[model samples]
Target chain A: MPRDGTATRTRILDAAEHLVIENGYAATSVDQVLSRSGSSKGAFFHHFSSKQQLARALVDRYVEGDLAQLEGSLEATAHLTDPAERAVAIVRHFEDLGDEIMAAQSNCLYVAVLTERQLVDDGTSDEIVRAVETWRVRIAEVLKEALAATGAHDVDADALADHLFVTFEGAYLLCRSTGDSRHMRTQLATFRRLLQSLLGPTT
Target chain B: MPRDGTATRTRILDAAEHLVIENGYAATSVDQVLSRSGSSKGAFFHHFSSKQQLARALVDRYVEGDLAQLEGSLEATAHLTDPAERAVAIVRHFEDLGDEIMAAQSNCLYVAVLTERQLVDDGTSDEIVRAVETWRVRIAEVLKEALAATGAHDVDADALADHLFVTFEGAYLLCRSTGDSRHMRTQLATFRRLLQSLLGPTT
Candidate 1:
């Protein structure tokens, strides 16, 4: 209700995201968030009633951002007439975003929640599952269209589609463990090159 | 040490592993491990001086098992003369173990400790980094040989090697979120097929 309410909410969410990513949601407390965000107890409670509420809000924010990126990539590649090139373009689009993604912790929050699913409520958990499925299904459709155009019956479209998600998530995890920022870009580039070869001249 | 000391230690480790995987390391307490393992505080203390010791021990035990499996796969495929075939066979070896892996929580411990590295000791964190590097370097060597044999200069051996790790960790995370056990095997199979295509006709 205050003039600075929106700024205060954004600060809390930003601070909470970093803490949740660094420490699991269960290990992170509202007090820690408040201290990190430099907000008072009144402001914290005003923004989120409970830690559980904060968890849901964090996940909702993350899932929205992820889906927006996915949609933006799809929309960017939608104009390509050849479905094969379209699919390849989508992979390239992600490859281009690899540096930013890696720099921002690379979906670590989504994955942290995923590994710590037992700690969160069902609604928060479902939001994650739904986001994963959205990527899987949407990408699979593009690959299916590509395969149809290429007459490539040797590969299952869904499996190939899932490869993109697998590589993205896996490379980020590797980046975290190894501290190798190049893993994301190089891995995605490898996938894009392979996808192009598999599509084969777009006949 | 008591006569049943070994069994007690095993029980503590098993319970700790499950709890640490389900909830991140920071969230799981020493008391929870004791309760879950049906062991007394005396027994837990007897096995591990503190929770930190248990964390290192867990990673040690897990790394041993993972390396053993990796080595076992390499040994099984050593008879294959073609390095490219050997590499593909190694992936197939893992594909056969997919069911057991998915059943046993699919490397969630490694990824969990990785995400929660801040909560772990330098020794434990180093152990995880070393284990990942071990997999990456060993597999990269084999892939390098395969590429040399096939005269394929387009692909980076390290990138291809990293793909296996990426696909693996990513697919497991997907499995956790989506409840799709098939992602592991299907993604690996797809990687193997694509890998074989890339390595085409070993000269």
Candidate 2:
């Protein structure tokens, strides 16, 4: 009887994500992933050709989930015609997501990659950059739309978008280092408040 | 004539800091530090008991310099009697610091330590937390003073202070990952703008 290759692959990825988040990519070894997942060396290799490949797979999967959440928020907010409301709603949506992540007590894979960029291969590194760029571009788009809708003339949508992203990354780091989950909530809320004030009252 | 042991220790630390910032603490070896600094294993062991000790020393040195800069900024802005102007000046001071960091093409050691927290010893880790707490408390003090002086009643000074720190950590991570120095300047500027808007015209 043949075993489920997909199940094995999922186990490896789950374990790898946890380890990478806990120990970072450089310190997380394939053997550790195998032992944690209870998968054999053969199963590990069957799923991932190399540690670098495993890293790539993990990043791709994370990117998929991340972008899905972003799209989900966009779809959920698509009904609102007001760009400002849509933008705020989208941020609130992520705030809710932050709540879920805090409840889960998981750190971000991207932060791990960002700090351990030189340890991973070029292709995997490029994916990290590409994924963050996608985020930057998407958030900037909505903000640009919101700024125009509000007739705001003094704000830079791009910079504000970067600020939002920066807050998420920074707050996550603080939360991880301090083990305070509310750090994320407070930081995101403050960003939202500042953003609202910058954009003025939603018209 | 005995060589200057202090000079040797400084060389090791300088090389270690660069490697840790570039490759992370776990991936960087004592041998690599020795090779980079042109110091022998005997010299390395003479200065530091272990890699963990080196990590602790690195963080201590970093924290000392970090707090010095913070104090230096506070001192330079001490002449501004108005709390609101003082707060704004403090933030502007950090924005200028961001510009300097970008120009130098360096990243934060605390961020590297945060991501590699598990690999470092408890004492080193505690120092990292303590250093950041000092920052949080100090900034919160100024922000609280500013808030009271501004007659603002709705703001949470502590949360706002955390926002500033979070922006620095997050913006630095993004800059490292993307190799875009402008990200820091733009993020810090936007933060300063939002903070000013929150504090209300700095009267």
TM-score of chain B of each: 0.92, 0.93
TM-score of 1: 0.94
Q: Please provide, for model 2 over A49-91, each residue's C-alpha lDDT reduced to its tens digit, 9 standing for 90 to 100.
A: 9998898899899888877876798898889887887787877
- Candidates in order have lDDT scores of 0.82, 0.80
B163-194: candidate 2 lDDT, tens digit per residue: 87798888887887678877887888888887
- Model number with the top lDDT: 1
Error of 1 at A170 (Å): 0.8
Docking class of 2: medium
lDDT of 1 by residue, A76-169 (tens): 9989988889999999999998998888864477777877756443667788787877887899899898887776677898788878878888
Q: Tell me the RMSD of model 1 versus the true structure.
A: 2.1
lDDT of 2: 0.80
Highest DockQ: which candidate? 2
Per model, kept true contacts as a fraction are 0.72, 0.74
Judge the docking of candidate 1 as incorrect, acceptable, medium or high.
medium
After superposition, candidate 2 runs with Cα above 4 Å error: A1-3, A149-152, B1-3
First chain of candidate 1, TM-score: 0.91
